[model samples]
Each structure stands twice: as structure tokens, then as C-alpha cells.
Target: MPKQNFNEKLIARLKTNPDFVDESGELLPAAVKDHAWKLNHDLIKFLLSDPEIKSTFFDEIDGHWVFNHNTFIDYINEKNFLANSYTQFRNKIGLNIDGKFLPERGEVSLVWPYKDCVLEGGQTKEAEKRKEIFFNEILAQDEINQMFDPKVLTNWKRHTTEGEQDVTDIQRDDNGTIRENLIIKGNNLIALHTLKQQFRGQVKLIYIDPPYNTKSAANTFAYNNTFNHSAWLTFMKNRLEVAKSVLAEDGILVVAIDHHELFYLGALLDEIFSMENRMGIISVVNNPAGRQDAKFFPTAHENMLFYAKNIEITELGRLSLTDEKRRDFKYEDIYGKYKLNGFMRRGDNVRKEDRPNLHYPIFYNEITKQTYLERQSDDDIKIFPIDDQGIEKCWRWGRDTFALRKAKYIEVKKIKTRYVIYSKLYEDEYEGEKAKTVWNKPYYSGQTATQGIKTLFGSRVFSYPKSPYVIRDVLEITTKPGDIILDFFAGSATTAAVAHKMNRQWITVEQMNYIETITVERLKKVVGKKVKEEGRLLEDIDYDTGGISKSVNWQGGGDFIYCELMQYNQAYMDKIQVAQSSEELVALWRDIAENSFLNWYVNAEVPEEAVNDFTALGDLEAQKHLLAELLDKNQLYVNLSEIEDADFAVSEEDKVLNSEFYEIR
Candidate 1:
């Protein structure tokens, strides 16, 4: 066959094969195409097992045979094959709409929309904003790598209940796991990449309440929250892709978002993690009374999307019984609290004909109130599971189950002429129950969260702080003590504080200027101190009493290491944003032109004509924006490899800590 015709012939053969259809009767090719043509290696292996398919692609080279991947990929790309197999299959399955333009209807894959571009998301401070960089602008991987190199960490301090101490070295456990809880201040995207060097496949759980992109003051993020829909998606996509690499194999990720981007976020996550790994979406009623400004429906709920790094091996934790749930256990015994459950089946497959084996008779003694699978004496009375209408029903358990736990667990009761068998359902028998999809509780309310933060900070310094109870419950259900939990969007340090109180190692990163004022201070207070009134200690009480402190018994004495990504050109950007007038910006521009690393496209000489043009723009904000853009985004932070360079003023203490953090010699 002609080399070009090889793919056409192979596609024709695959179309006729019945093995291409899955158990659900969906074409496997269609499913694969939905996922950007990234074939499931297992399915590829299985398909190659067929002699007809194997012989067509496998070529014997010397002593071994090699499957021609390019030829197979070409076959999968054949338009006629996909149109006939995928589009027709969707239509047959009732997924098509006459007027709708579904993304899947096109030849392009779902992730292709943003795949060809990269958003710089270079906003390192609250005032800075992102710039889009197309694939064509990105010359090579080397350039991208240079921009994302491991950053140098400075200002390392270990905080304890006693006081803060300079940290020259990182503490690691016997297994070489970093023992210190960490709070790093920088751009979260860059911070995540830095963390991946040491924490790849090490985090147990990651929970982030990221920017909702709601275009409202209530939910605005510090790193420029006014991005357009596609820009917002690209921003999230860049961070989420890195976040996935940092997750442990069995780690769980939970993302909190409002309705503004819920559907789009879901689609993005599906593209990144695949649908098979998706756990479920949880609806949390954070606003019980609802927002008054809502146009139609008063919005009261936000969603949490849960996913696992590998769903098959991910083990979920259970939630403790609520007061309402505890009420169900009405009876108590020496063993513990328990309730009576009907031994007879009440739902589907309850009919005797449905499960004839379970419909067998059981002997019951009225005096003893005990149930037996078989009669022991004449006093024993035979009973059948029958309803009031005289319809026979099957026992919930089969004969084998009844015989196994008949003495201790099964109980027989008599009321009038009818006999009922019950099973002792002990509350202690189960550790706890799985959390439901909807979580509506008083403690989960937004007002409660605001009040809690006010109590901690003496005022509400932050907007919409997440409730500590929410974070506590998240940790309780998803992690064990000592497992690392990460929250890149660590607003107000709620995740870190909760993680510390719950006994999990944590890492939080924030880029906003408020990280020092609010985020770190919250964590420092979490480590324990007496409540102060006007900078004076009110009492000898050594631990915080607000939020979940009493619930988790957090008489906190833990500590965390705080550090910052040493700024390079980012310093100039900060100065530019703070400049008040055109004269000040002009003066700042002079300093920037001499000292800062400018974008490759920006002229280095600070041409007098260009300076005159900059002055002519009279608008201070416009001048500031232009000056900020002139600085190179790639050199925002000092890279780890440049720590020894004297021009950046690398302190000896910072160099030691940076080496220890990155595990470099």
C-alpha cells in the first residue's frame, strides 16, 4: 500500500471492528476524541492485541517489532472516520441539538481554545495586571523555562509562641519530608512552580477558594480580578496545570467557586484531570439569606468541585454524625448507641420472586425475643416477611447473613398478630457517614465567617474570609494528621490556620501586599497568645478562643516558616504603581531605565524623544501602566541559580535558607 493510504486503510478496518465500541455502546474513538485524542494507553495495548490490527502497524526491525504510532495517529485523525463514527454516534445517542453549536461538533478538541496561547499572569502585586502572550511570541521552551525558574526565597523567619527567629536551615523529618509549615509570599503561579521542585506528589490535599471572577467588589482578587472570560480561563488554566503536578498520586483537590464561572471551570477541570477522576460537585449554602442585589433568584449557594489525582486509589474520609443524625440512634446498650432497622427489604427487589432465597422462613420465640434461621424446639414459632396486604417480601439479608449474626444482632418483635425482625444498627459500628452533595449548616454561613475574622483581627481587615469550620471539616474528611495541605490562593490565611489547628503540615502562598499585614499575622496569632486590648494583654489566656478553636481544642503551640520570593524587576513595578504624579513617574522611569530589566522589545537607552512622549501622555495612571509594562515579567523574582551573584545583594542567611529550601548543594 502507498504510505499515505496506510492511514485510510487502517481507519476503514477500525470502523468495522466491534471491539471499538465500549460496554456502554459508545464508540471508544468518540470518547478518545473528546479528550483531545490522547489515547488511553491500556486501550491502545488491548487494540494491538488483535492480530489483524497488530500486523497492519507493527514492523519487525532487527529482532524486535515496533508499532508505528504516527500511522495510527493519522488513522485517528481521518475526518471521514471521525465524522462517521463520532458525530453519527452522538446523534444516535440523542446528544445533538438542531440549533446549538456544541464545542464538540467541531474537529477541534475542547482544550484547543486556550492550548495555543499562554497568559503571563505577571501580576505580582495587587495593582499589577496580566498580559497575553501568544504561542507565536513564545520562541521556544527555553524562554518559558527561564521565566519559570525556581525563585530565591528571602526573609526566612520561624515563628513560634515565644517569638520569631531567623531561619538559616529547614527542618526535615527522618524520611526527608520538610517538617516546617510554610507561608511564602509571591505570585501564586510562580510559587506553585517553585513548590513543585520539592513537593511533587507530596501534598495530600489542596483546597483553594480562588477568585470567582464575579466582577464585584465582594469577590475581587488582588491579582487583577477584572480579566475577560477567556483571560480568566487562561489565568486559572496556567495555575491549575501546575497545581496538578504538585498533587500526590492519591491526593484530593477541592475548588470553591460561585456560579459566574462554575460551568467553564468544570469543563477546564475535566480537560485537565479527565472526567474519570472527578469525584462530585458539592453545593454549600454560604449565604443563607441570599444577596439582595440579585436580579431574579437570590443566590445563596456556591459550588466546590472535587477531583482526585488517581480516583481508583484515592481513599475518602467520613464525616462525624451531626446532632440531627445522632438523634436517629434512640436506643443505647453496653456496646454503644444504636437503632433498630427493619430486616425485611422495602424497596426494589423486595418481592419474594425477586429473591426467593431471602424469602425463607425464620423461627422466632416470643418469650425470648430472639430470631433463629431454623427451629430449635416446639416453643419456636415460624415467621415469614409479609406486608399488611399479604404480599410476601424478602429479608434484607440472605440466609447466610441471618445465620452469621442471628444471636447478637437480630431481634424479633411481636405486635398484635404480626411479627417483625429487626437488625441492631449500631452507631459505633460505622466510623462516620460520607458527606452529602449539599452541605447546609449555620456555621457555613458567610456572616459567621466575617464575624469570626472580626473577632480574630479586632476588625474585618479582609473581605469574605472563609469560615474555619469549613476548612476544618474539609481536612477532617480528606486528610490524616501530618499530611501536607496546600492553598495557593491563601486569602486571609484561613486554610493555613485551620490546617495548623487540625495538625496537618501546610503551605500557603499569596502575592498581594496584604500577605504581611493580614495573612501571616493570622497564622502567627493561630500559634497562640493572650487576647490583647489596645496592644495590652487582657488576661493570661494563652490560646485563641475564636472560630473552631474550642471545637478542635486548639490550644495552639505550632509554628510556621515565613519567606518571600526576592523581588528583582518587580520592585520597580511596585514603585511605579505607587507613584502619584507624572513628575514622580518620570523620576521613577529614570531610575527604572538605569537599574531595572526591561522587556526585550522596550528600548534600553531611554531615548529623550520617547521620554518626551511619555510626559505628553499627562494621565498619571496611563504613564504608570506604560512604565510597569516596560519592565521584564520574566525577571520579577531572583532565580535560585543567581543567588551567588553579588549584583542582587544576596544575604548569606538568605542564601543558606534558599539552598536548604530547594535542597541544593
Candidate 2:
């Protein structure tokens, strides 16, 4: 038999018992208290096979020896020996120098929830069926240790337009309210941490459409740039951990991904946001007619993993009724347009035995063509539930309920030989329906997303922009009119445009060079600004009008600030890349020593005064080599800790702006 996985509820119950210990005398503290281990059916069977272990954890219940939670935790902890000491596993994939790995300072190691689960291919058939137990190995490592290290945010500037006038330094509106919307151009990983300084625990919703990392060269939508499995996992792991920090306790996170990385991403999310906090997985059929490149089953849907910081406080908004749904109320009465809905209970456990009180009969008067809960005379015809296919069913209401509400709700119709009963479901009394997990909305298609960008920009500028309507729908469900929405991946700024149209505050970040050309220009058109594309007005271009501006009746007036990560190492790298000769390289090396600050991690012993010694070197090649060794190539931004340092030269004007931007003062 396959192994059964213990749920969080069972784990919680196990922690309450004090006498829980395994056959090997190991305590259950780690597994029960820290969620450090999980018990599967196979492992449970193994324990039961041993008399000493079985006696401790199993109890006879109704002829079966059921596994006890207290004993199970103890048994698993003994089988997998865990220690409090921090230890380094060998660098199998070569991510570190000298084949020795060290955990980043303050990194917490998570215990593997399952033991002896083989994840790699070529396991037994039964083991292959137990994929969830095996998959937790992918998330067994410590959380990305270097995630929260401080970085710099620089090149701050606000961008807005007032009736064809380009404005830059206007920080406040006419009423002096600080602008809430922001468009950041930089590495999203660094930008997320930067935004956390001001917006942590304040943002209500986050919708990120990150790189799918589908390794198909022919796939236009794939990021094209590929990372090995481990690298991809680390990249997503680092970003998601920080993203979770910025979310409010009641906030919702919606991520869009395809099949290629769905399982891995889901596992990573399980580790970051404990499995208990997962809201649901929505399957959106973006391409109803399956893609041609699919090998086995033609792919038609993408997954949207929705999670809440706290499930108790999370509530989703409803979707409005469509015209087709409204048309269901075809019949009219004095009350309103009404529809005939059968007054019979259907589906599982709906028989008389299930709801005995609701199985009563109704009386139909042949003369007046009216139904009643009570019989008036002997001539009155009695009716009972018999479905269209002639199977017996039960009435939806009890006798007392039918008696009190029959006059207003019950309707009678005469078939050839019998009477049919229905309840008048009125259109005026209809509330919106709950949003479903399967989304087949018309506007979620990739074609719609493409046309939306083309219509706004007068050409195809971005690859695979999400439909603004889809974003609007997400916003409508997850946010109120004044809530804040963030999209760090901000491709084509669709989330920002939708948020602006929906009257919600928004923040978006993009790392591409097209931020000025495509993302900013799209928003400009959204705000009714006449954006010029190559010296021509976008409004003059002939294109189909199906985007948010036309649908929302947007006239447009809002402001957003644009900024970039302050360049330190990248500036020097840029100069080095452009140097034409050895003399130019020598000059560039001198410029870097004067302008940039070296990362403290690079070499703490090297003092700032020692920079002069390198610049004094006569050999050009030696100068280049020494400068490369001194600078930390990975630390692109100036550290926040070094903002006040003399080498960074942060002016008084910048210090005030930095403080104001972060809302720290």
C-alpha cells in the first residue's frame, strides 16, 4: 500500500503529547514543533513491522492498528538523525570556491519533512506514485542566506506630464498628497528589497508574471536565456522570500507560470509560505485551441498560484453576471424578470434519507394553476419530485419553509400528464456569483494581450504582455478601490495600467532598456497624454480599440515616479567595455578608483587610502588585473550602510530625498 502523508492538523495534535519518543529513544520535538519531518505510509509500515517501534506509535482501533501521531513523529525523528549544528554539504554543482560551502550568516536550515524518499528517476513504481513526498527534497536546503543583504537605490526622478508639459521634480500634488504610484527601472530582486523599506506589510496585492524559464528555443515567450535547474530554483527562491516580507498579513500573491516550472515553483512556495497558507491553484485557459508545439497533450492552460499571508483574513470578491447569465431570467412578473429553477434537491446525499424533512409533497390546483404547501380540497392534484430521467429526488424546501415562502417563490406548470414545480429566481434579487478556479474568460488569451500592447504603442514593442482585462479582473477580486497593488516583473506595465484604471495605488519595476520606450509610453497614453512614437502621435495610428482605456472610459490624470539602481561597479564595467586602447583602459582604471566604493566583502583589510597605490602602477595590464581583483563584480549597487560614507559622496540634497523616499524621517 502507498504511504499516507500526515497533515498539519495531525502534526499539531502530536506536539501536545509529552511522552512521544521513538524505538531508538529520539524525542519528537523537532518534527512536531518545528515542522521538521513528515510521516508517509511506507515509513509507517516499516515502523509497524518492528515490534518495539510499533508498540510505541500504533494503537488498535476498530480491528485496524492505526498510526498514532505522537509515536509517528518520534519514529521519523529517530530514523532521520537531526542535529542543531550548522554543517556544510559538498558543493556538488560548484557554486562556491575551493569546494567548501558555508551558510550565509543568519541563514536558517529547514528540516526535510520526509525520510528515505528517493526523488531522482528510476525509483520503484509505488515510489514514483508518491511524488509529493519525494519532491520536498528540492526544498530541503536552507533559505537563500544572502537574500536580505542591503543594496543601494539611486538615480531617483519622478516622471509625469501635465497637458503636454513634461514634469520631473513634482513630488506632491496640488493638494500636497505624495504620489503613490511608482515605476522603478532596475534589477527586480534589488528593487523588491528597496520597496520593502517603505511598503513592507502595507501592500494589499502582488501579481508577478516572472520568466517561465521554459528551455524551448522555438518558444517566443520563453525567457530564451536559460539557467540550470539549481540556478533557476535559487533565482526564484531569493526573490519570493523577499517578496513575502513586503506583503501585508491580509495580502494576496498571484503568480503566473506554465507547466515547465509549475511543480518546482509550487514546492518553493510551499517552503516560503507554509502549505497551510495556500489559497488555491487557478487554471486559466489562455489558449483554448491548444499550442502546436506540445508533444503529448497540446497545452492550453497556464497555472496561477494564489496564496494569502493569512487565510483567516483573506476574502475574494465576486464576478459580475454576464449578459448570457442575465438572459436566464426570461419570464417577467410583478416582482421582476424571473427564471424557473427546479425546486428539487439533486446530487450526492440529497435523497429523503439525507434530508427527511425536505421530502414532502406540494399540491397543484388544476383550476387556478397555482401550487401550495397545503391541500385545499380532494380535487387538488398532489406532486412529488421525479427528475426528467424518472429517478426519484427530494424537494429543496421543508414543509414549514414551503408554507411560509410558497406564495412569493413557488410556480406551477402543467405538463401533458403531471404538474411541474419551480421557484421564481428573480433577476433583481441576484447577487454576483463566486469566481471559479477554472478561468475561461474571453480576454485572457495571448492574442488579446498582444493586441492590447500594439493598440497602445502603435506597434509590437513587448513580448507577451498580459491582458489588461485579466489584471483588472485580478485587481477587482483582490483589492478595494484604494488598495495598493504591486507587480515587480512589470512587463509592458499592464498591472500598473489596470491598477490606475481601477483607482488603486500601484508600484512596478522593470530591468530592461525598453522601460522608457514601451512601459512609460503605454502609461502616458493611458493618462490621456498624447504620446509621440518616432515624432508621431499615438492617437493618429489606426488600430483596434479593445484595451482598458476604451473599456474603462479612462480620461486619465495620475502621476508615477521613475528611478534606477544607482550604478557603482556597473559604471566602471561600462567604462571598461567602451575603452578603445590600453591608454584608455589605464585612464578608466584611475577613474574607477576615484569614483566608486569597493564592497566591504571584497577585502575588509584594504583601506580606502590604498586605492592610490593601484592607480600609481605604470603597467596597464597589471592595473586592469589589480582593479578587477579589488572590486566585487556582483555588488552592483552602493550598499545602504555606505550611504553616509565619505567615499560615496551622498550630498545633503540626496540624503534628504533618500530619507523622504523611504519615509524613514
Candidate 3:
């Protein structure tokens, strides 16, 4: 039997990384790896013409490798030879009555009109051909080796670094569950790119509250603050592209933005989701505090756009209560658990091919009290077997179903080709009216934060959180129990906390500082944590007046793994360029090793035996240390050095020909 595949998602992920490269600064080989399409791992294995690519370019410690863009490009082209492979595929398809020969350079073109007829990408052959060429060209370009729009990458990385942001990393626990919580940092561009694997066609619902691009001088929008109209639109556009992929066959995509970006976002949504999936736009009155604007109408309403992947004539029920409604609701089991449906059974409305055994209904024999259902000739009628009771009631079901339904069904009551089905309820049964185009629910109404916080947590260390009632209301309506709820703009983790309380896991990512008092404090109170802490986290989150100070200043407290996104410094890169000899390189490394802000405590010692040429330990003063065992050509050890004195302790030993060891350093 063929084994299952896990590399499918990983393969898809590799297709997204343009800057991914080998040690020589060339494009990385396209192989199965960390990122692959969901389930494709079974179909394809991770491959690499050169498997040591990561160590070559990423590590940069190996001196044998040199960064050369042109050479790397050549290698990528050679490695991607299959992309240029072409073979005729025979196909039989349709044409118009007079035969429609599409025009040259039509917007769309067929990939292999013979084997598979999948319409995707664009319509023009020229366009598709151009795409093929462009894709190959993109693969061969050296631009990928450069910083990805440096300013954008830097700002995003800086904003979403470990301590500055809170992003939950989750994955599907089982295939049965469709929903999952995802929190991604870095530039949303890169983050979304990575998500193509796990989420393509798998997301059931998406709700994004993006920045509204309102360029109001007094509005005050910034990196960490909020987005102005153009900025927000651009950001949303990039993120939506990936979000669209995660949606399921019957999935939905929703966006939350104010008037500033509503019109534009609506247009963009139409482009990606298409007008068919565009269920409708909802106007939410979020703010009760009206801005008294003298010049224009004060901005108040925000848009909640809804879209679904597919629409069908599904006879869904109305509400969960009511006498008349329950009457319409049918039951099949003893406990009334198996509700009966009125729709034509799977075969209700069928073509002739479906009911081959069905014939015209026959009348019952009143005098003989015998039933005859199937068509019979003179001889066949005599053979029409009689029931033991001598009363034959003609069956209403088709001939083929007579035996099957007879075996399973014990009809208690029956009407003219219909049963007492449970569906479509009256207004009286519901606590409120059925859903309307306008959502006037308390969640949408806003201004309930104080009450909700007090109810969920009585002044336990947090305040002014979103109402879980509202989040629950929306989830009950639009989402299933298994769906992933993403709140990138989550204030106090209201959405996630609500989702969790409802047994729905969620991902909450926030960048505000004094996080303990804001998102942290709220989550602690909301999650109803049992563990008590020694000290407070960050004092508050609303202190920053703008995006950030650019110096990677953290304004919060509490225990969190401290880390910041970092890259090679240009000045250091220049110094490395000038150094041609190993001695110079060593000196350069020494200078950087001593000067960088690594916050090293020299007394830390290296460990006994941790990794090759390295060890973790505690030094004389009892600080953490990392020791590396320097080796010679025959793999002979030379000396041990401390990499991070505060992190590890180090010791080295000399070994004999037979692998006997002696303490060397």
C-alpha cells in the first residue's frame, strides 16, 4: 500500500519563497521540505540536487561556499528543468454550434485542453504563455537574494518580533476538524505566503479587521496605531490573497473596515471572492460616542462584509423553538433524535435513468382486498402474490425501493407522497426574529465592554474587554465549533477568549506594549488561570503615541522569551567584504563578538558534551556557557571557546588513535 503524504503542504510553501537561496546566494533548490502542500508529501518526496544548501548560504560559516547571483540563477534554471518540459496532451471537448475558435491573445488559454479542463489563472493563451515565461523568469532572477522591500520587511519584523507581539502558533489536530486558530507575525506578506499549505481550501470562515485608509491628519494612523485608507487597503489586499486560499468549498470571507476603505475593499473583494460569493455588506454601528464634526458627517459605521464560496438551495430550519415549528419538524427515532426530512429522499427529483423500476401507480383491488403495485400482464397478474391477511395495499414507493424501504421503514403515518417533516419554523418559537440583513445584535451595537468584563471577570486585573456575548453570537451564526478564529487586531483577546470559552480554539496576535495589563491581563482573567504570578507584566498598552521608536524598545513586562528580529548589519557586511584573509576574518568576528549587544555574561561556562565542536555548561561563576571543540584536518581537537558565556560552560579533550580521551582545555 502507498503511504500517506505530509509533504504536500511543504511543497506548496517552497513555491512561495522567492528569496530562499543556497549558500552561494543563489535560488534554493525546489525540494520537499518544511513547507509543502497539504497531503502532497505522499505524492512527492523532498528533493534537493544539493541537500546541504541551508548550511551553505544560511549558516555562512563554511568558507568553501561563495555567494554568486548569476551562477545561482543558472543552477536554479537547470534544477527547474521540468518547468520547461512540454508534451502534447490529447483532449476531446466542446465547441459552439458553428464552432467557436477563440481569438488570438484571448484573455484565457488552455493548459492541456486534452487531459484536464481546469479553468484557472487567466483566459488568454498569450497571458498563460506569458505567465509560464514570467514564472520561469522570476525563478531565475537575483532580486530574491536581496531584502524583500527592505523598509516593509524591517518595519514588520520589528513590529511582530517575539516579545513585541503575541501570536499563537497552531495546526490542525485531526483531519475531521475543519477549523483552526492561526497567528502569524513577520510581514503579513511572508506570513500569508507560508500559510498557503495548511489553509488552502480549508478555511470555513475568515474575518479580518484591517486598517481603514483614512488619511485624516487628526485621525492619527501609524504602524502600531492603525492604517490610513491607502495603507490599509494595500495591506489588506496582500493578506486577502492568501486568506482566500484557506476557505473551504462552502467557506466565507469577511472584512471589517470603516467607510474610508469600504467601497474600495468591496471592489477588491469582488475581484477575489467574485460577486457570487459576496453574500452582502453589513453596516455596524460600533461607536456610540459620536464625533461632533463641523465640516462633515462624523465617521461612525464600519462595514462587515460577508461572502461564501458556494450557494445552494438548502432547506435550513428557522430557530430552535415553537409549537408550529416543531410540528413541521419530523422525527424518525424513538427518542425523537433522528429528525425526519420532507425533501425528496436522495432520489426525489430524478431522471428516468434513476427510477428504472418505477411504473404508473395502480389502483387497489377493493373487492378482493389485495394490493398490486408493479405492472403485470395477464399471466403475471395471477402470479401477483397475496399478503397473508388477504389485504394488499399498493405501495407508494417505486418498485426498486419497495424491498429496501420495506426492510428499514415502519411508517407510523403517511400523507399524499409526503411525511410530517420538521423544518421551516414560525416566528413565535424563536426568542428573537430570524436573521435579518441588518444585524442589530448587542455585539454589533458595541458599548457593552464594561458589563461583559465585569460578568466574565470581576475586576480581576483587567477591564474594558470586548463582550464575549457578541463574539459568541456571531460564532453561533456564522462559524462552526471547529473553525479557527483569527484576531490580528485583538485588543484584550476578547475574540479568542470567547472562542475558547465556547470550546473553539483561537489565535490572538497583538503588538501593543505593557501587554500584561492589556492583552495579558485580559487573557489571564478571561482564561481564568489558576497560577498566580510574582510580579506584574507590562504596566499598560495604550502608552505609545505612534508605531514604535525604531530602536526595538519594549514597553511591557512579565515573563516572555525575549527576542527581536535581526539581520546582518551593513557596516559589518562592509568590513567582511574588505577582509580577504582568514586572520582578518577572525579579527572581524572577534570585534563583532565583543561589540554586539548580545548581553553576554563572560563567567558563564560551557557544558560537557552538547553538540559537535560545541558544548553547553556552567562557568566558574555559574553562568550558562557554550564551548566549541576546535578540530584539525583528521578531526583532531585543538581548543575550546566560549560562544555565550552567560548561556553555557565548555571543556575540551584530546583523543588517541583508538578514541581514548584526555582533558586538553
Question: What's the candidate order when arranged by decreasing lDDT?
Answer: 1, 2, 3
For all candidates in order, the CA lDDT equals 0.73, 0.62, 0.36
Q: For model 2, give the RMSD to the true fold.
A: 14.7
Better of 2 and 3 by TM-score: 2
Error of 3 at 598 (Å): 20
Q: Write the per-residue lDDT of candidate 3 for residues 1-665, one digit (tens) a residue.
A: 11112223322444444423333332234322212222233322322223443332222335543333333323333322222111000001110112211111122110100011112332333121100000000111221222222111111111211234422221235563424333322223333433444446665556555434343421213211111123344456656776777666776666766665578888888887777778777666555544456258775555678777674521112223323344544544432423343212333533334444432343333244333455344422222112234432222356565545432332222345322212222233334335445554444444465445444434322322344544555555666665666555555566755565545545444433323345555444433322224754433443221111111232321221111111223234335434444445445545554543211222122222212111111111000001110100011111112212332221121111101111112
| TM-score of every model versus the real structure | 0.74, 0.65, 0.39
Error of 2 at 324 (Å): 4.0
Q: Which of candidates 2 and 3 reaches a greater lDDT?
A: 2
Look at candidate 2 and give me any clashing residue pairs: 3-41, 4-41, 38-113
* Least well predicted 10-residue stretch by lDDT in candidate 2: 129-138
What TM-score number comes out for model 3?
0.39
Best by lDDT: 1
Candidate scoring better on lDDT of 1 and 3:
1
Alpha carbon deviation, residue 289, candidate 1 (Å) = 3.1
Error of 3 at 301 (Å): 3.0
Candidate 1, residues 1-665, lDDT tens digits: the string is: 66446545554544454545443333445333322234446546755676766776567789676766656544554444444333332233222334221222222111101111111223233342222211101112232435678999988888877668877678898877788899998877778888897888899999999877553445553212112354467678788898999899999999999997899999999999999999999999999898867888888888889999999999899987766777899988777889898988898989999999999999988787777778978999998989889999998888898889887788777778788888888888858978889988899887898778777776556767787888888888999999999999887899999999889999999876778888988888888765667887654546567888877777868889999989998777667656788889878878887888865645666556566666765545445655665566678799988999999999988887887878887
> For every candidate structure, what is the RMSD over all alpha carbons to the true structure, in angstroms?
15.7, 14.7, 24.5
**Highest TM-score against the true fold, candidate:** 1
